[model samples]
Target: MGALAVVAALAVAECSGGSTGASPSAPAPSPSTASATCPSSLAPANPPAPAGAAAGAAPQVKLVVPVDTSTSTVLKPDPAQQLQCGKVQVDTKSDVAFAAPKLANGQAKQLLMDIQVPQTPGPKPLVVYVPGGGFVQDDKQGNLPLRTYAADAGFVVASIQYRVQPDGATYADSIADVKSAIRYLRAHASDYQIDPGKVGVWGDSAGGYLVAMVGVTNGDKQYDLGENLDQSSDVQAVVDKFGASDLSKLESDYDAASQQAAAGLMTVVGKYVNGPASTQPASATPATVAAANPITHIKPTDPPFVIFHGSADTLISPSQTLMLQNALKAAGVQSTRYVVEGAGHGDLSFTGDTKSALQWTSANVAAPLLDFLNQSLKG
Candidate 1:
């Protein structure tokens, strides 16, 4: 925890701290089908393990503490402090093709991303943003406000488009696309002004689940598919915002009424794993669902995590985040949890664009988030 710098007044933070058609028959090729070759200098001889893989349980860090009324002054941004809402000068390269995995029909489906590089110094830390769209759609630009804010703060942000259920993509395909994007960025770090050694991931909702998988499965060859095999996809830190962790237990965590409200989403989950999750027996959870759960892959060696979820989320229960936090804690992995009071699923207060909204986010969300990133990636 020495890596993280303390931030004051985090806003009453109660901190606890798919598929269609037939499933893909085999994992994608390691080197992938991209024509580009990674340079020997940049390519790792062997896949690098997660940052703390060999180290024992990370030292416990006190993330939140009781604050006095006077701490409210810290909420006001200093005159020289950069604004977290407005647009800043950033160079963007949109629709950059990173990977092309072969589809069911033997045709290659190209994966794309938008890179936002702050017109600042060189070799800045990179944060890959994966937006959530319920696995049915891909929206690389879904959270522009936060993406720009991070860029303006001197981080290279890449918002990526991955294969979704509509594209006949399964869990394996979507996971592979995300890892491929990480490897792609590292392979071309110089072009993007990225620090290949310091990479992190941030995602919300369904995208949150994907980033968690990426974090837990670090150095796991099974998920490292497509191009840039020479490069590693292991991340230093992870920020999961209300992503479902355990699919098998997802329904049981909800109340009767909440389950009814989330019926459509459950159907999508069934399609995602190509099976019925709710009907499965407790003793016999579906292999696909088990494989898709981030908690299933948690280990003491995994990277540090910061999780956020709204206390009033209905579609996905707050218990889902608790499940992940508890598992990570039990495994001795470094983790911090914050329950945003009165916020619901995908609340705009967490990612709003208005001036007032940004002010709230700067104090409540951005402060701790950037601080954690600084500790994990830059420390």
Candidate 2:
């Protein structure tokens, strides 16, 4: 099947039942019965907040998503991708629309977010998901496959799409959109029956990088401009799947193939790496990618994190997770990791083409992911 056909097929399977279709090589993350254990990140007195954040206030942010439903659903899950084994009452819902941060056009694109609120309420935890496509591709109109998975496992789940770094747009704008979405979620948690304080952020690939940015810079005054008087939209937990954690380190791994792909991708994402090479060395080095990585920002005060990756991923090395795990351990923070044997980037599939890959990841990564999210989100 063609790309479009594959998507349609996946959609059908998501809406219907199991996807034991074509035996494509690149399978989705496999589903497994065994779950993972999420280390608790709760505090006795009060969950740690940013500097001087008001007590008992939930972190909030503006909804900064852009939706294109032409080929995608109305922010619902693709039938083909639904879990076949686990039939937990997801209690999923839709029509949770909001406006993203304004673009250079003096207006932001309309965002259609898929929200899954728990049946049992009383300020439930929240987990926002960002889909990855190098910041320019992918749609958010359909049910975010990962969000539904997270929701089924527990937390109030959300999947968002940020404005792309078009040929003329800047990367900074994409970053701004993330902050906007956080603010939006924080301000409107009650509407979705979520615990404003227990918000956690997670994403895959480029989405993973976006979540990292959100984690490292949560307290930045520029991005923390929310109306929440009680708390900031600071997340209590994070999960990154093979995202670019450090730019310089990423650049080091930039081979001819990657540079070629990046050259083509840069224009689409609007990354104009212009100007002459600086004469002086940057304050940060590629090796410190780990130190300068989101793991650097990790502390006992920061939210717990769990990262998963394929052991043999070429796009983003598995070693990245090792670095993150080590950092969290050294800092006395809570964390865990799982690596699939032969996955690449963040392809979380287990049927059709990548059925094997999917199966492996499910057995190794996604299942663990559910447990990790459960521990953090279910208080």
Candidate 3:
């Protein structure tokens, strides 16, 4: 099957029996089942004391994320409260239409967003999670662990879906969809009880690239498309893990052959640029390529970013992350880089000079990850 066919199949599989748009009430999915689907590492090490407390003496926040195995639904928000962050509900609304595809015969697909809301009501900070599949596969369902963690950490979490390559969508199209989602969330902040100004984005690999795009393109009118034009798509912070910095230049980067091959039969970069470089070289010329490069868009006013990339990753050179870090520094943007030694793409492990590479990241990485989000979004 072609790329579109494979993703279409996955989309069909994803939408099978899943609900969207509204919340699921009555008997919820069993905690055991919901808990089973979430990664154990996502559980909160320290639970928050209560909703109201001193800033200096605040209690550790506990997290609760109910997983929806069958359907995606939206819960009606209670207008009575301000910030709610306990006894959460999980609703995975499949095929919530976001926008039309850029390709012919490309149907406007639904955004399968798993929205986790706290029972308590308040204008909580928001965290949008994007998944990684080389920008060709995978949907909003790919990052339950991070979604659960962010939700538990007290942010309104939305794991959004975006169109991928060969589906008639380029990297620009994907970024536009992400922006639309952010706008959608901001537009309906009251309904979701979100702090519109305190939104953050997180993703891995291709998703990381999208998150970086969101961070770098803040206030740029080029990507504000489809709906919610009045609302800003700017994110306050970004968490990118092993994402490619420059897609157009990937062909010349080390491991270019293997990276292109791993991307797909048709080059993912080619699809992003609308065709193979030979037929449409100008379409992906250095200028156009730089146009899509996140490093090219970094400005002093851009939000802070916390980046993670495996030093030993063979698919994408670690230098991509390094270059991004350097660009952020040159622009005077606050950025952090976690060079995971011996880690590969999507490897959450962060062993620092002891034991094994995969063992201690939970302590060394997850804590800092949470701290960064808390400082950036909550601070």
- For all predicted structures, in order, the TM-scores are 0.72, 0.64, 0.70
Worst 10 residues of 1 by lDDT: 3-12
lDDT of 3 at 145: 54
Give one digit per residue, the lDDT tens place, for model 1 in 135-223. Answer: 66566756665667677777889988787655555677788889999999999999989999999999987788899989999999998
* lDDT digits (tens) for residues 180-203 of candidate 3: 989988988896678999999998
Scored by lDDT, model 1 comes in at 0.64
Can you rank all candidates by TM-score, best first?
Answer: 1, 3, 2
lDDT of 2 at 55: 23
Ranking under lDDT, best-scoring first?
Answer: 1, 3, 2
Off by over 4 Å in 3: 1-102, 251-266, 275-284, 347-361
Best by lDDT: 1
RMSD of 3: 14.6
Which scores higher on TM-score, 1 or 3? Answer: 1
Output the better candidate (1/2) by TM-score.
1
lDDT of candidate 3 vs native? 0.60
Which portions of model 2 miss their true places by more than 4 Å?
A: 1-88, 141-145, 167-172, 225-231, 254-261, 266-300, 348-352, 360-364
Q: What is the C-alpha lDDT of each candidate?
A: 0.64, 0.50, 0.60
